[model samples]
Structures are given as structure tokens and as C-alpha cells.
Target: MIRYPAYAKVNIFLKITGMRGDYHTLSSRFMRVKNLFDTLWFEPKSTPEFEIRGNFDCDVRSNTIYKAYKHLLAATRSDKLSEWMETHAVCVDKRIPSFAGLGGGSSDAATFLRMCNERLELGLGVEELAEIGANVGADVPFFVYGYESANVTGIGEVVERFDEPLLDFEVVTPQIQISTPAVYRYYREHLYAPIGAEETARLESTPSRTILASMTPTEANDLYGAALGCYRELNEKEGWFFSGSGSSFFRIKDEE
Candidate 1:
């Protein structure tokens, strides 16, 4: 049996660039926080099966971990590999909160892919694993590569690593859960904007610290307006900004 830690991420800066078909394109800076994570345990079994046990409230089969396993299993497509792969069971000890914009689900899926590749000796490299991860979810590739910080763009397919100090931050989730799709739908209907090259370049050139320090209500998240409509208290909080399409908001604080 092997255990893996699937960490949580915070979007330091997120901007909607445009729309690609039905999907929204974005340019964002992502940072992984070490203090928050989900723990997954994988043990070999004679038959392929998945079990999730934790504070999570979701169907076991519907979990991203299981989907990742199935996706990778199909990718191999060898009778021998399939048979060998089927004889495995995964137990997830989830800690990260869902729908909080922490990328908890994506992290779980990506970690499972890496664990399976190593345990099954699939010989898939980081790039191959990231490709498989991307198919599972947009944010999965980020966790698959396991970068501490990255500038992610192109609807999350493009990732560029950069140097940044690990941050100490606080995250708070409201009782209310906001749907990501709902937020995007609201954005498209009410607040869609075409981000020009100049704006994109300015955002890219701005240092992380500068962005964090200057995070006005308007600049924190492009989806803020939609989220505020759904959760009015979000507007009442000081120093808190929505994380992703969020019900959870966070603020960077000084390290003790």
C-alpha cells in the first residue's frame, strides 16, 4: 500500500481572457498551500474497485479518483495491463473542502494518476501523466506536475513555472456552496469582457506581491460580481476575496 498527499491550491490572480466555444479562457497564477491537503491510500486488490472514506459528501464511483483510474486504465488498453490494473483498490481520506475553489477534486485525480503510474509501472512520464490528467480535469495537470507556483493560461492547459516564496494564508468557506458552472453562466450573461493584449501584458508583468497588495474588490476575481450576487456576505468581508468560482474566500496573512 502507498499513501499520497493531494495538496490544495489558491489562485493568486485570476482573469477571464475570453471564451473558447462554451468554455471560458483564463490567465491565472496558482499557488499550492502545504497546510491543506487530502490524503489517499492505494492498496492492491484482486479486482479493480474504488472506495472513498472521509468527510466528503459524494458518490464513491463519481469521485474524480475513480474516474482518473478508469481513464488511465483505458489509456493503457492492454489485456495484461488491464487485468493487472483492475486488481487495485483506492481509499481516499479527504481533507480539502470541495467547491471552495481549492482544486481539491482536481488534486485528488492528479495524485491518483501519479500513484497508479508508479505502482503499476506504467512507464508514463510527467508530460504523459499531465496529458492524462488534463483529460480528467483542467486543474489536474497542474497538480500532476507538482509545481509550487505557476502562471497558468489558455483555459488551464498552458503552465509556466516561476519563482515565488511559499505563502501563509487563511481560507474560510461559507455554509453556502456555489456552483462553478452557475458562476460562469452569470459571467457570460452579465459581465463578459474581451481582455486585450495590453491588459494581459500588464497583468503578466505585475509582480505577485504587487497583485496581492493591490487586490481591490474589482480586480481580485473576474467572477466576483456573480459570486457576490449569490452570497452577499462575501461583499461584507474585509480582506477576503473569492477563490475561483467560489463559496470559499481567502486572504494572505503574515506568517507567525
Candidate 2:
């Protein structure tokens, strides 16, 4: 049996630089939060089964954890292992809220991949796992990379690890669900613009904290305007900024 914790993350900075075919190109800073996470338990069994408990309200068959297991089995190209996995029971104790732009689902998938690699003694390295994860979701690669902080780009396949200054913060999740696809669609219609080379250079060179402190309203979240417009009360809140294509907002705690 193996148990693992899937940590939640915050996007300290998000910029939609442009579009690539049907996907949006992004440059952002991601930080893993220490206090928020979900738990997963994998026990070898003779019959395959999966269950999710806690705050998750989604179809079990479609859960990322289950999908990840299938992806791994396919990647290994082992009929025997695939049959064994069909009998293994995996349980998820979900603590991270879904569709809140905190990368909960992606994290769950990434952690599952890691656990399988270790327990099954698959010698796949981080890069290999991350590549497999990218097929699952953009943010999956970042979590698989297992860095506390990173500069993420290129539909989230590019991860440049970096050390982030310690900071305190709070996340507030509204009783709402924002579809990532919907948010991106709205952004395309209302706010799509090319980020100039100079601006991109400045964003790349600046520290995340510095960017947060000096970020213009437009630069904070490209999808913020659309999200705020959809949920008018979000604008009424003070000191909170949208995270990802959020229904959740966050604020940095003041340090004395």
C-alpha cells in the first residue's frame, strides 16, 4: 500500500502571451501551498476499483487519478501490469476544491503518477513522467516535476524551477465553478492581445513578488475582467485577486 499527498498550488503571476492553434500560450509563476492538499491511497488488489471521498463531486470513472493509471499502463505496454492495475484499488480523499483554478485535479493526477513509479519500481525519471503527464493536463507536468516553485510556460510544458521568497497568503473559494474553457473563450473575444517582446522580457526577468507588487490591473489576470464581470461580487471583495481561471481568489497576508 502507498499513500501520498497531492498539494494545492497558487498562480502568483499569469500572463496570456498569445494563442497556439486552439490553445492559449501562458507564462506564469506557480507555488505549491503547504497547508492545502488531498490524500490518495493505493492498495494492490486482485480486482480493480477506485473511489473518491471528501469534497469531490465528480464522476469516479472520469477522475484524473483513474485516467493517470490507465495512461501509465498504456505507457508501460505491459498486458500483465495492466491486468494487475485493473485489480488495484485506489482511493482519494479530496481536500482541494475542484474547478477553483488551484490545480487540484492536475495535482492528483501528477501525484498518482509519482506513486505508481515508486511503488511499481518503474525507473521512469521526472522528465519522463512529466512528459506523460502533459498528455493529461497542462499543469500536470509542473507537479510531476516536483518543484516548490517554477516559472511555467508554453501551455505549461515548460517548467523552469526557481526558489521563491517565503510569503504568507490566504485563498478564498466562492461557491461557484468557472469552466476553464469558458474563461479562455471569453478572454479571446474580449481581451486577446499580443504581448510585446519587451513586455515578455520584463516579465521573465522580474521576481514574482516584484511583479505582484507592481502588476497593473490588466496584467494581474488576463481572464480577471471576464471572471469578475460574471461574478460581480468578486469585485466587491478587497485585497483579493483571481487565481487562474478562478472561482477562487487569494490575498497575500500582511507581514508585520
Candidate 3:
């Protein structure tokens, strides 16, 4: 029998820097939180079945946890990777609020991948694990690599270690949920714009810190306008910022 503690994370800062032919280019900061998590328990089984139990409303098999396990089995070709991996019960002690845009689901999937790799002795390298994680979801790679802080980019695969001190922040979410695919669809259908090569190059050249330093608190969240258009309640908040093309709006207040 095996159990894993899946942690949750919050994006300290998130920006869509540019869009690539295959994926979007991004620049953001990430922090693991002590507050929210989900648990995954696995044991030997005759056939593969994933059971999810907790606050999550999504289907178990479709959830990243199951997909992550399947990906490992395919990559490592280990029988235990498939055998014990079969019919696992996910007793998700979910504390991270759903639709809060806190990367809770992605973190859970990453934690599962890390623990399963260890239990099954897959000997998969970080990059290989990250690649497998990417197939599971865009943000899973970040949790697999577990860092205090990072400058993440390139569909959340390219993570650069951050040397700056960790910033303390508080996150707030309204009673709304914005699906990632839905947000992307809205952008494509209504707000698509041609790549602004000059602007993108300029944005990339300046350090993210430098850019962030110049912005006022109220001016954060570039996606707020589009997100509000999707969910009209966003306009009621005076100084809220959208967290990752989300219906979740937040304001960062330093911990005193």
C-alpha cells in the first residue's frame, strides 16, 4: 500500500508574454502553499480503476491523477507501474478551493507522478518526468520539480530557479469558475490578435521583476478585461486581478 501527499501552489505573478506556434509563452512566479492539498492512495489491483473522493467535482478517470499514472506506465513499461497502479483509490483531502485558479489540480497530478515513479522505481529523469507530466497537463511539471520559487515559461515546462526572496501574499476568489479551455476559446473566437513581434520582443527583454515593479497594484492582471466580459460579476470588484485567465480574482496583500 502507498499514499502520497499532493501539495497545492499559487501563482505569485502570471503573465502571458507571447504565443508560440505550438504553445503559449508565459512569465510567472509560483509558490507552494501549506494550506491546501489532496491525498492519493494506491494499492495492488487486478484491473485499473481510479476512484476520486473529496471536494472535487471532476470525473476520476479524466482527472490528471489517473492520466499521470497511465503516462508513467506507458513510459516506464514496468508491470508494477501498471499492476499496483491499477484500481487505486484517490481519497482527495481537497482543501484548495476549486475554480480559485490556484493550480490545485495540476499540483495533485504532479505529486502523484513523483510518488508513483519512486514507488515503482521507474528511474525516470526530471526532464522525462516533466515531459510525461506535460502530456498530463501544462502545469504538472512545476510540481514535479518542487521549488520554493521559479520563473516559469513555455507552457509551464521551462522553469528557471528564482534567486529573489519569497514574497508573502493573500489570494481571494469570487464565486466563479472559468475553465482554461473556455477562456482560450473565448480569446480565439472574439479577441484574437496577430502576434505583435515588436511588443513581444520588448516585453521579453525586460526582466519580469522590472516590469512588475513599474505596475501599480490596481493595474495588475492583463486578462481581467476579457475575463470580466466572460463573467460579468468581475466588474463589481474595485481592484481585483484575474488569476490565469480566470473567474478567480485576487489582490496580493503583503503579510504584515
Candidate 4:
């Protein structure tokens, strides 16, 4: 039996530069959690199977672990594994909330890919696993890199691993709600002054080392304004900041 903790993550900084024909161009920094996570258990079986347990309020058929397994099986041509009555049972303890833009789904998918590769001794490289992961979700590749911090871009497929591990941080999610699709749609219609070209230039010019040093909890979430506009609960919160596109918010902690 193999049990792994599926850590949650927060975007330290997020910037939407532009939109492509099929993808959104973004610049962002991410940090992972140590205490909070979804739990996954892979138990040996005679056939390939998946079962999710916990408080997740989402469709099980479209779950990340299932998708990851399907994608991996296709890429590896391990039809034999599939032919078996079952070789493994994936059980997920869903601690992370769904549709909160917490990347719970993506993290689950990444963890599935990693565990399968190790269990089957597929020996797939990081790039190979990430490629499979990208097919599963835009954010799955980050977990594959196994870094505490990373500069992520390219449909969330291309990851530039950071040299330094991120400083200690804490993340807290508010009780409000925001729809990611609604926020983007609203922004497209209103067009509230794109993320200031000057601000982007200044941010891009700052040395990576300095940027990490100067960053604060308040400046942590770039989706603050848009999320707050969508959900009023944020304005009342003192330290909470939005994560990803909406709903959930976070704060950076002082310890590692």
C-alpha cells in the first residue's frame, strides 16, 4: 500500500498578460502547503479501479485521479495493466474544497500520475509525466516539478523551476464565493484598465531575488480586485487574499 499527501497550493502572484486563441497567457508564482492536503491511498488490487471518499462535492466520474489514470494508461501502452481484472485501487480522501480554484483537482491528478509511475516502475521522466499531466489540467505540471516555488507559464505546461525554496507561508480560505468563469467574462465586457503596462514593466524588471524578498501578504494575490468585485465577503476580511481566479483566499505565514 502507498499513501501520499496531496498538498494544496496558492498563487503568490498572478498576472493575466493577454489571451491567446485557445489559451490565457499568465505570469505567476506558486507556493505549496505542509499541513493542509487531500489524502490518497493506492492499494494493490487484481484490477484497475478508483474510489474516492471524503467530503468532496463533485462528480466522481470526472475526478482528477481517474483522468490521470486514463491518460497515463494511454501514453504508456500498458494495456496489460488494464487487461488485468485490476492492479490498483485509488482511494481519495477529499479534504480540499472543489471549484474554489484551490487546484485540488489538479493536485489530485498530479499525485495520481506520480504514484502510478512509481508503482508500475514506468520510469517516466519529469518532462514525460508533466506532458501527460498537462493533458489532464493546466496546473498539474507544477506538482510534477516537486519544487516549493516556481515561475509558471505556457498554458501552465512550461515551468521554470525556482532556485530557492519559497519562504514559510500560511494560506486561509474565506467563506465567500466567486465564479472563475464569471470573473473573466465580466472583465472581458468591462475591460477595467489592463494590468497597467507600466506596472507590468516594473514588475518584470525587478530582480527575481529582490521580488521574493519584497513581496508581502497583501501583494500576494493578484486576483484580489476581480474576486472582491465578484464576491463582497472579501472586503470585510483583514488579511485574506484571493487564490487563483476566485472564491478562496490566502495569507503568507512567517515560518517554513
> Which residue pairs overlap in candidate 4's backbone?
46-86, 47-85, 47-86, 47-87, 48-86, 48-87, 169-253, 170-253
| Per-residue alpha-carbon lDDT of candidate 2 for residues 1-256, written as tens digits (9 for 90 to 100) | 5579898888877888888999999888888877788888766555455544445677877788777877877788756556656767667788889999899999999998998788767888999899889888899999998888888988999999877674566888988888889888878887787576687667777776677688754467777877766666655355566788887777676721
Evaluate residue 103 in candidate 1 and report its C-alpha lDDT on the 0 to 100 scale.
96
When 2 and 3 are scored with lDDT, the better candidate is: 2
Give a tens-digit lDDT track for model 4, residues 5-45.
88787776777767777456667766676666888876556
Each candidate: RMSD: 2.2, 2.1, 3.5, 3.3
Q: Which of the two, 1 or 4, has more TM-score?
A: 1
Question: Local error of candidate 2 at 113, Å?
Answer: 0.3
Q: Can you write out model 3's per-residue Cα lDDT over 1-256, one digit (the tens) per residue? A: 5667676666555556657775556666665655456666654344555555567677777777778878877887887665564555555677667766777788888888888778667788888898999988877888888776666777788876666554444567677877676666565566555335565455445443454566543244445555666776655455544566765544445422
Off by more than 4 A, model 1: 44-48, 78-81, 232-235
lDDT of 1 at 120: 65
Model 4: weakest 10-residue lDDT segment is 79-88
lDDT (C-alpha) at residue 125 in model 1? 93
Encode model 1's per-residue lDDT on 60-177: one tens digit a residue. Answer: 7678876887788778764645565456566677788888889999999999888877876888999888888888889998999999988888889888885778777788877777
Candidate 3 runs further than 4 Å off: 1-4, 43-48, 188-219, 252-256
Residue 28 shift from truth in candidate 1, angstroms? 0.6
TM-score of each: 0.91, 0.91, 0.80, 0.83
lDDT of 3 at 239: 50
Off by over 4 Å in 2: 44-46, 49-55, 79-84, 216-218
Judge candidate 2 at residue 59 and give its lDDT. Answer: 81
Q: Candidate 4: deviation at residue 216, Å?
A: 7.7
